[model samples]
Target: MLTLYRPGDGPWHRLPAGPKSLVLLVIVLGVSLLPATWWCAAVAVGACVGCYAVRGAGMRDLLRQVVTVRWILLVTLAGQLVFTGPETAVANTARVGAAVVISGLLTLTTPVSELLDVLERAMRPLAWLRIDPQRAALTVAVTLSTLPVLARLEREVREAQRARGGGRSLRLFAIPFLVVALKHADALGDALTARGVR
Candidate 1:
């Protein structure tokens, strides 16, 4: 959500978005390619995890993010554990966790607008193929902006369900959430049109 970006004078904040993104990609790929050994993957994951402390994020903040992605991680762990083994499962899970943490760190340090600018600049050469970098970057920016709105909507829907009591149907929230999301999209589109984004 919007919780990703934290305003501070940290070293990560001082780094350029391009290099940070490149390093993040390399680190994630390198970790993922490492052997599924406890010792090897653990060291890499530990280093990635320690980035939170280096970037001034608190334990509570890190735990909140992990909790948000718990379901996805749980499913991945269960599948790996069943098909492979405990060692592979743990290693794969750690790899995924480290990748997510590193990506989150990038977003936390870089502002969304600046990240979009970096993306646009990187994709400028693709304009020769009729791919508009500005539009592409704007799409990503809008997508990032919607995440926090969706998260807020989810929380509100959950609270409303709890207030009503005696029911546990995902449809109870999904339908309303979809409706609100569509409305948000419509508004966003209208705003973009007004601004002559096209």
Candidate 2:
């Protein structure tokens, strides 16, 4: 699986995944509710940075994850600016960027197996409703793993287009990317079946 976990001997890595995940959820909820003010944004961003530093992750590692969503952030900022004015847009962007960084920090610190185990355990209560916790956890794991694959595929397609001196064309990229993604999904499904994951 394409997990963001990096092997480290840091305290964050040593922490129990269950509690860590709970804390992550709490932090996300709290942050999401904060007013989109400059100070709130600064605190949110600073907290993420501080957490990374405490966990011994480098700045470049954090930037790598954050940069992936730059285009989305840009578009969001543009729309907010047009609709709500510059101050709100800036605050909103900062709020969003901070959330993304915080999420990335969590994934970077926790291993995929640990995350899945925690998720399955947390969903155990749903068993009373005839819901399969393992299946739900596996689905989430697969979805998380697929994101990096799609991101890498997009980057590869972009690079290939540039190499061929092609103009910016979504049409040229979308079809092949979709085909590759579908094939990847099929292969992933086969692997999961072989492992008796679902």
Candidate 3:
């Protein structure tokens, strides 16, 4: 299922998923509201590093999370630099990067089952609005599981393109990537149907 949970006996790992998720939400919101300043960016990134250290996660694990979103961060920085200035660009990129790291830490410590349980329980209040908590939780689970799959598909497509001397052509990359993604979606739908999801 492409679970990212890293088994550990640290305090963060022992923390309940509900509280951990709430803390993550608060951190993300706080980061979003902070001004685009170098100090703010440094503080945000520093907080994430502190959290990782407290959680006993290695620098390598944090680096892996950063690497996963390197391209996105670079593009964001570039666009901001052109539209705004270097200061705002770096601050915004750090803000986004910190948020991603916080999220990765949550998933690293909490099991998928625990997260789904928390999500389901949290959605119970919405049942009066005809919202099915189970279905909603299942949807979230599927979405989370699909992200790694899509990432893998993207890497494979890029590698194949390069092998055929396609260089960095977006068109060549997008075409095969989309096709494979659609195929994965169709298969996932079939599996869900077989399991009586609907």
C-alpha RMSD values across all candidates: 2.3, 2.0, 2.1
lDDT of 1 by residue, 52-120 (tens): 666456566667667666666799899899999898888888877777666666666788878899889
TM-score of each: 0.85, 0.90, 0.90
Candidate 2: tens digits of C-alpha lDDT, residues 1-198 = 222778887877888888877776777666777786778867777766766676557777767776777776798899898999776787788777666667766667888888899889989999999999999987887787677778888888888888988768989888877888888889998999999876
lDDT of 2: 0.77
- The true-versus-predicted C-alpha distance at residue 28 of model 3, in Å, is 2.0
Q: What's model 1's TM-score?
A: 0.85
In order, what lDDT does every prediction score? 0.76, 0.77, 0.84
Off by over 4 Å in 1: 1-4
lDDT accuracy of residue 33 in candidate 3? 76
Better of 2 and 3 by lDDT: 3
What tens-digit string does per-residue lDDT give for candidate 3 at 71-101? 8789989989999988899999999888877
